[model samples]
Target: MDQFRSFDQLRTNELSVLRHGFFKLWFELTDGQFCYGKLSYGNFWKTIYILEVEKKTWIIKRKGIFKRSFLINDLDGMNLGVVTPEIWSRKIRLSMNNGFEAVYLNKKLISRTFTLTNDQFGDILNIRTELWGFKKPFKISFDLDMLKKIPELPLLALLGVNLVLIKQAKAANAAS
Candidate 1:
């Protein structure tokens, strides 16, 4: 995986996952995010329980109600701050996308995403994966207030979220 850094050369996945708290060091989207995770001591399933979006909303999916019959926009946030798996992802995906589309797999599942380097543009590292998929997309939702009570998360992976946010804010002002 490339430990190097550059601002101009960015990928869609990189931009999508930069603003995280758990992030320590990242190369790019192809290089899966595998820093120190606040994994539980137990040997139970350790998939990413929640995923944050746009540095604001969080989605915590239920035990079985994955994306079954829904659109990405169907996901909604809870009235309280608590994030559920159902409400955060801004489904930028399309039908027949490059992924397992047969609903849910009974066996253990893993995902590894990759990207080409700027110069060489070769597959360098394998990125993060979701242990589970949404059976029905509409099953997701969150409570906004839950965030207020929920202490800081340990799996706070940061994909340069702060840096990008600042840059975007600056660009917005410049454009305006």
Candidate 2:
């Protein structure tokens, strides 16, 4: 539905609803690859996955394996669920809450500029350390192409830790 707005468009519209979620969409045309990282509204992070369409499969680099397949070939093997093909633009919103969001795309989820209004500039600043152990906390971002190796695929490890930090804040706030 055209009425379904792009995440970027939604940001421009400036709808306020406490917080919202975004679809995970990242593509590096230079490398001919596509990836997805979802963070639900105020929820924790979800593992990102890359599609190996040439092979007709999606794969995730196993943790502790370091760039190795954590699952066997045909990761889903039919049970993994259907792989739906749709075309549309994609935009992601990263809020101060720090969580994984998964939104369905009406289109291909390719390129769309989305904006996120964060209520906490200082909270993000404050949680920087607890989120990223390094002395400097990485900025809250929905970036997809900041890679460490081979065309700088998304900055995953760092992003993951940041999710942890965000979740902690949510948990603490709930307790309070």
Candidate 3:
């Protein structure tokens, strides 16, 4: 287990989310030097994900059998937040119990870029997919000031990558 003290210690505002293996869903949040966090499957079915940041862990899983939303829960089973997708749209809303809310939406209808924004901070983070990898790695750039405002910024970044993966899976399903 990596001891991630804080994102403030990072030397750069930009980081990359890279897959761990050729066929694995595990990903690491790194700035090419220090690892800030990680995101990996919690179960074999791929319905649950384990997010680790700052030596703390959280589980992200589907809300129910018929629901499209996912729940974020602490190790003690306390619900911390929820990620809900908008109907007939490409936007996803994330709400935390601490009264924090943000929306992740594509930069354009047909683009690979996505931005995470809230009413107060506007655009806090930008995530772009790399075009040259089978794993579809992502590059994330965030505002350190805005990150200081949102304590869950790192977890949300991991969730943003999850959302992109879900969107791609849906698109592939629709095409086939």
lDDT winner between candidates 1 and 2:
2
Error of 2 at 27 (Å): 18
| Tens-digit lDDT string for candidate 3 (20-58) | 865566888888877888888987778999989886889
Candidate 2 lDDT by residue in tens digits, 1-176: 12222222211211111112236323211111221222122212334444332223334333343432122123554333221212343322231112322222212333221222223221111111223323322223333322211121122222333333334466698999
Write down the worst ten-residue block by lDDT for model 2: 10-19
Task: Order the candidates by TM-score, highest first.
Answer: 3, 2, 1
The superposed Cα distance between candidate 2 and the true structure at residue 100, in angstroms, equals 23
**CA RMSD (A), model 1:** 19.0
Measured with C-alpha atoms, the lDDT of residue 106 in candidate 2 is 15
CA lDDT of 59 in candidate 3? 94
**Cα lDDT for residue 8, model 3?**
72
Question: Against the true structure, whose TM-score is highest?
Answer: 3
Error of 1 at 112 (Å): 6.3
Candidate 1: worst-modelled 10 consecutive residues by lDDT: 133-142
Number of colliding residue pairs in model 1? 46
TM-scores for every predicted model: 0.19, 0.21, 0.94
The per-residue C-alpha lDDT of model 1 at residue 141 equals: 15
Best by lDDT: 3
Q: Which candidate, 1 or 2, has the higher TM-score?
A: 2
